[model samples]
Target: MENKNIEVKDENGNDDLYEHFRFLADKGQQPLRVDKYLMNRVENATRNKIQKAAKDGNIHINDVAVKSSYKVKPHDVITVLFEHPPYELLLTPENLPIDIVYEDDDVLVVNKEPGMVVHPGHGNYSGTLINALAYHFENLPNPAIINGVNNTNRPGLVHRIDKDTSGLLVVAKTDIAMTHLAKQFFNKTTEREYVALVWGAMEETEGTIEGHIGRHPKNRLQNTVYLNEDDLHKGKPAVTHYKILEKLGYVTLVSCRLETGRTHQIRVHMKHIGHTLFNDARYGGDAILKGTTFTKYKQFVDNCFKILPRQALHARTLGFIHPTTNEFMKFESPIPKDIQQCIEKWQKYSTHAEQ
Candidate 1:
């Protein structure tokens, strides 16, 4: 059997648990029901899981949605998508406080704080937004049921943000709401703008960063942009439009709009152009990349790091069509206190240095 494994990054551009799989039947294969075929071929897969996937329109044959009973002929192409990792974790609700921006029967908007994991994953199995959501929305809608099987592990979560990135996120309260919001995100109809403080002043006041983003071949924990045309297909297209809002002496605060939400799009693109986000530990912005070689300046930089220990990124604005009412909705979040203080400290330091 011909097989291919693909890593499907979460649409929110941070989570890395979702996975997609594709298979091509061997030329000598006999006709078989698609769900039955998948159960036999996919390790740890059950008929109920396959049926649910088919019911949710997640199972496709030759790029078209198919039913569980659809016959898979020789050389037929098959594919399936999982919202979370294959390894199931016992989801337990915790009484964690979340900043609820707006809530309705169909959807809710949250102002996710810095250092909060959006969902439970590899190293984080608790104290996540999912756990908090589970606590709050205990009876949230479940996925499609087929043969008495339903995956209710992740309820109400439609998108996510990075743990260190503070921002606005929307959650769906029902399956229909989830599907509607998911389609909007997939079609790139949602509008998201982030405010970031980068290590250096930008040469241009406004510009667009265009590149294909993919996993770093050497470092599994990092993502890089592919500049070579031949290697473009190895990654996915990503675009970030940025405008400098303020140019501090050592760092610049900028507004970024995302056209395509590839993983780490803003962070990687800005780093590629030599303006990594301030205090972004993973992209090497935690160090003093730009500044004078003065003891006072070094001390000032250290103080700023203490003020905002994580990457200086905030999802300031989000816009999308309402899942239930079909009306366009938009939400804005102010920069967190830590980042605000960091900016104030830099402003004070810059003024002192000029004097």
Candidate 2:
């Protein structure tokens, strides 16, 4: 049987479906940087965007992660993974309701819901944030257009969060706003904080995880943090600052601040340190990683999964300089109801364990 939705395992591992683009270089193809080669084949793709994808280990040649600078050879099979679907010229605007946290002429902050794909892709052609935005703003301009081509679907998207990870995200309304905001993200000046429930207690109250994050060598479906310095180019520099907010017997609630935004940075880095987010099935957190073997305990976890079907992660806060006014701006999102209920259940379980 074919899996209709492209399921991408989260770093900690809840199965979030994603779209992927695959290509094969013709035998007569000339050697060129992978990024440059991709721009021609990928609709509406810019060199910068392609390079960023390569740096994040989303670009592959014959199943091995490659850098943007890597030259593509004739008959070399290539693939690029996206959290969202590849750009198709036809982007139908759908009238989906969006939770607008704040909006102005220049920018808007949206509180994205869990299981909502940020943009439209292969299997998911409608009901995305982009589709909603296109309907809301009838004339929004595409941010990363190149060579007189524009991505009609992804207009105003400066950055993106995962499909299953609910959180706050900022969108640009104009070309100037998009350029300025994209620069902020590229320079690592933007601030993002996430709150997550992981399946273990931390030895330290607060610490930083620094590693190179890229695609898993074997598993093209997921990202992994490279530990060796020699393989740094294969991945990008990623830093996450975490503080334990609460200890719930077998699971811990953590506040994570991202210094550098790489794909799946927080989830993968947390798992790298042995603290996969609770119910993150991809990274082995879905099972009882640190809990008791008792049937009751197993039943309790199963119940939690029912309440929150995906990984326990959320984008709680976002801070950046206003593109128009250059003033500092920040926004926050409350924990979604499902995660709150899951945490409450853990709290009650911890209380009972103490007795």
lDDT of each: 0.81, 0.81
The ten-residue window of minimal lDDT in model 2 covers 1-10
Top TM-score prediction, candidate number: 2
- Residue 226 CA displacement from its true place in model 1, Å: 0.6
**TM-score per candidate:** 0.75, 0.76
- lDDT value, residue 210 of candidate 2: 93
lDDT of 1: 0.81
lDDT of 1 by residue, 1-355 (tens): 2222244544466665343456676564567899877776564567898899999877878877799999888678787866665433467789999999999999999999899998765467688998898898867765542122233455676667899999999988877888888788878899999999999868898999999997675555678998897777546789899999988888999999999887678999999999999999989999999999989888989999998999999999999999878999999999989999999988887788689
Clashing pairs in 2: 13-280, 13-281, 13-282, 85-121
CA deviation > 4 Å runs, candidate 2? 1-87, 145-152
- Score residue 282 of candidate 1 by CA lDDT: 88
Which runs of model 1 end up more than 4 angstroms from their true locations?
Answer: 1-87, 142-153
Q: How many collisions between residues are there in candidate 1?
A: 0
Consecutive 10-residue window with the lowest summed lDDT within model 1: 144-153
Report the C-alpha displacement of residue 257, candidate 1, in angstroms: 0.8
